[model samples]
Target: MSPRFQCKQRGAIGLMAVGVLAVVLAFTLLVVDTGRLYLEKRKLQGVADTAALEAVSRNGTCLAGLSAATYAGQSVARNHFVVGNGNTLVTQCGAVTTAASGQRTFSANPALSSAIQVVASKTVTTSVAGGIWSLFSGNSVSLNTVLTATAVAAKPTPTLAQLSIKSTLASVDTANASLLNGLFSGFLGGNVSLTVAGWNGLLNTNISLLSYLDQLAINLGVSAGNYTQLLSTNVTASQLVQAAITVLTANGATADVLTALGNLKVAAISQAPLTLGKILQLQTGTTAAALNANLQVFQLIQGVVQLSSNQSAASATLPVSVLGLANITTQIKVIEPPQLSAIGDPALAVANPLGPNAIYVRTAQVRTQVTVSLPVLNSLSGLTTAVNNLVGPLTPVLSGLLSLNLVTTINSTLCLLGAGCQQLDLLVLPGNLPLNIVLDAGGASSYVTAYSCPTGSAGTKSVTAHTTTSLASLNVGNITHAFSSTQPMSVAPMPLVDLGIQTCHKILGIGSCDPRVPFGAGGIAIQVQSNIAGSNSIQDLVFSSTTPFATPPNVGLASTYQAAAPATNLVSGLSTALNGVSITAYQPSGGNPLGALAPTVVALLGSVSAIVTPVVDNLLAPLLNPILNNLLNMLGISLANVNVGANLTCGQTGEAYLVI
Candidate 1:
């Protein structure tokens, strides 16, 4: 090549190299700055994400009570990225927004507190890019680029479960039409005049929690997701009646049930949604809500009727007549609160803020009374006369007689512990007739606690209870019987008896008779008594559950259960003071006196040995003992057959949920 051309070519090559270098520098600055932006953006995103999550977790619900959530969020963001600490800068500190439907929105409204959103920005300075730009332009443009990152997070709203009863009216006592009618009327808002068949219809229907909730949602014309709206809706009395009719109609209830529901009254103008807590409170005569307002009025009415039916079945009245000598009747009742009768409280499984060691349970109480009436011994005197005629002048004891009656009432309270409850499932609470009983008699009482354990066999459990009662002073009042005015007599004291004496005496031209002593007696009264209090037990109160345990989102199978100690000493220090009992002469204070009669009278008086023998052994003992034993037995109730209903894990109140 020529030297001149080669020099020109070299200069051109140098110029091309300079141009290429300039392009490379521009590309390098762009790439470096872009990379810095990305890294800073990622860091800011991390800060926002951490802050948002922490904030939401701290304040699941946006409320004034949990104002610390904002502080926690800002602290977390500052820790991750803060101005003067690095390239990080939180342009908007403590800024929270709700993100839903792929959009982040902010408003000064309380309803949008479902989500927490954090926005963070960072400024990344570039030295190399600025220097390179300055070299070419002889001035530097702003190389600090601001990058922002945002994050949204929220927790899901917690759900609660209302109990669903799966029981039949067969467990209820329908024998007493009055009791059944009254209970039905009270719960149904008026007298529906339910017949046995109608009661059967109500009792046979067992509803599932989910199905009921769905039906309620449908009736409310809302989706299941709109639980808050459903809960907030006011339910009128007419609406409640209509809802029941709708549910029953949908479930193919009997005609009688439909008619009965149709007949319900619309007295309550408007009411809030029924809740389990409210049901329990109502049973206890209170109108307070115990659980979340997740149930409608129809559901509450259904629960009320179910429990009332069961209780009705548990109560009974029977008429008893003992050979016309005594007529007695008995009334028995089993009482249980509706809520505790169905599903136990979840709070009970953990702890009762009200008190410690307060064993919560689904309970049933038993109360029974026996009314006894006995006429005066006037009728019983016939037996004495008959016996005297058969024994030829061996007249049985006789004494003062009058009308007598008695009222014996016994009350018992029992509870079923450790019940299984599930959310959104049918709950068939065990029909343990009676588990543990607290027996109260007069002023004395005893408590019996039952221990039940699940057996190895599926769906089987056992219960055993023990208690002792030693009543010393049981005030069984004095009894009296009347005889004819001319021939008054009593089996309680001794009548005249002959001692094989050939010498007979006649008084006032009457028939001859040997002297007989009357034992001291008004009536036989047991002042103080002591006996062993026996134990009562029932086995295999088997309860089969299709939905006993629960999974996540619902509280799992509860490991915590309440247990209590039974009363060991039932009735101690019983002091009895029996009255109207003594052996005395039945003859008048003054009578015919003679030298031979004196010895005979003394000998007859010595016959106090046989005084109580015939009177007690033949008449009173046989009739009275059995009655007393039966009365005692009626005071005790044994429970078996336990069933578990639906379970509910009501999350803490004011729990927030993610809406985005």
Candidate 2:
């Protein structure tokens, strides 16, 4: 029993040990293969993630020269991932689109480079369990498995962009300086006195936009680096001027500029509060560094003052003397304030430039009414004498046209006593008359329409914008109603001269009579209305640097806009109006004094035209042209021309991250 039992037990023990050893060996092989596969997958995933991030951060594009795949391959090589021979790395350029429900999807586009996607795969030996099964099955089977990883990354939406709108008044001479002083002084509701040199200094000075915003934030007690809040804050004109002073002083502005700014600041003390956002538009998510552009001091100050005036209740009044023969008074009201500059993300603007959130800028809309008082009409005696001489010779013709014997009427009235009577004297124009001219300038506007970032070192960066110059209207006539800011002026023919009869009594060669009176039926009036057409066009504002926001340049491209043919010429307008002179007739309170002469009076208009035209031209050529032109030039309101400036900052590099 001992020998047989011992032998059987030993054999059973050896068999059990063999089976246990086989199970342990299989389990160990499974564990080792699993670990190997996991490590390979982890390495592949790392390569894909890093490659995607690197490609996006490098600003790689799918455009012609530098492609996203090229950048991703370099990154994979740097990460020690070999491609080819059963190991593959695929890169794609695309964009990540967000749906209304906030779901995101990646769309591959060879033309788009907003995002980068990478797929990395490696072929390795199959798991130990599969090889063991294949050996037992006695049939040749595949022994390799593929592991793949995918990753997508992109930079944040909305690269930075900037735009500026400039005034056409580039320089200031003595005449312009005086006009500026009067205009700004009236806008501020205070006296602004600056020398020509001081005005020119202000015009030539440049202020850093960043520094100005920084100083403004400090002045308003806003936290640093909060440009968005700073721009939207409402600050008085005095505060804006003070911030400009601080920035200019820090930037070493000239003494004359400083003095001029000081004077302006004092004048702006009583001005109302205005939002800087109204004048300078900054889009959401704009970084402080993106605002590193420059602005002309004069432009800044002018924008602020105009904005303040637009919100106020008072209108600016400027008194001017034209040709020393007429005293002209101009009342200017800003219907809408100007958008002097703007900075933003071009992506949003490209979608819809005229949309509510678009980065659009426009010049100011102004209504200027010029009232001319001819207190010195007596000084235009030459014109009056010419008109009298011309009409005196036509008195006989006028008798036939007027259906009345003017010579006989004068004799019957003044020679009642049978004494010699003086001839009938006709005065062309009265001693004093008031004339009014109104001009409505609906300034120009510009907005971003498209943009592109640099794809390579030699790639050009640019921003395209659509510009529209608005139409301007000029009215030269008599306005019976008060001027309105929102409504168009109702212009009627201005009474230039009144054709009437003068009665006198002569006694012993002495004359005693009633003064000449206006005709009860007929008078002369001048009416002129002209519309200056504008233009619409597209412009490209190029950027010199790839990363403009990093350190913005001081200046940018400037575009000048001009109206269509027959630019704004006040004298020309008046002259054209004079050519179209109208004769009006009205009945007296009782009845028509001329009875049947009304028709004849209207017929006399044709003959009077020839005489009135030359006299009016003679008066206007010498008295109105030079003065009106000088006044309009000083106001910087050319119905014909405008200027706009633009700057662009695509975005900064090295800001890419995993988005999906």
Cα displacement (angstroms), candidate 1, residue 111, comes to 11
TM-score of each: 0.36, 0.60
lDDT of 2 at 360: 83
Residues 148-224, model 1: lDDT tens digits: 77666555533222222211123333443334454344433344465666555555554333344445556767543
What C-alpha lDDT do the candidate models reach, one value each?
Answer: 0.36, 0.67
lDDT of candidate 1 at residue 493, scale 0 to 100: 23
> What local lDDT does model 2 show for residue 602?
60
After superposition, the stretches of candidate 1 with alpha carbons farther than 4 Å from their true spots are 1-37, 53-61, 76-184, 187-189, 192-359, 366-395, 399-638, 644-660
State the displacement of the C-alpha of residue 527, model 2, in Å, after optimal TM-score superposition: 1.9
User: Residue 462: error of model 2 in Å?
Assistant: 3.0
- Error (Å) of candidate 2 at residue 232 is 4.9
Top candidate when judged by TM-score against the true structure:
2
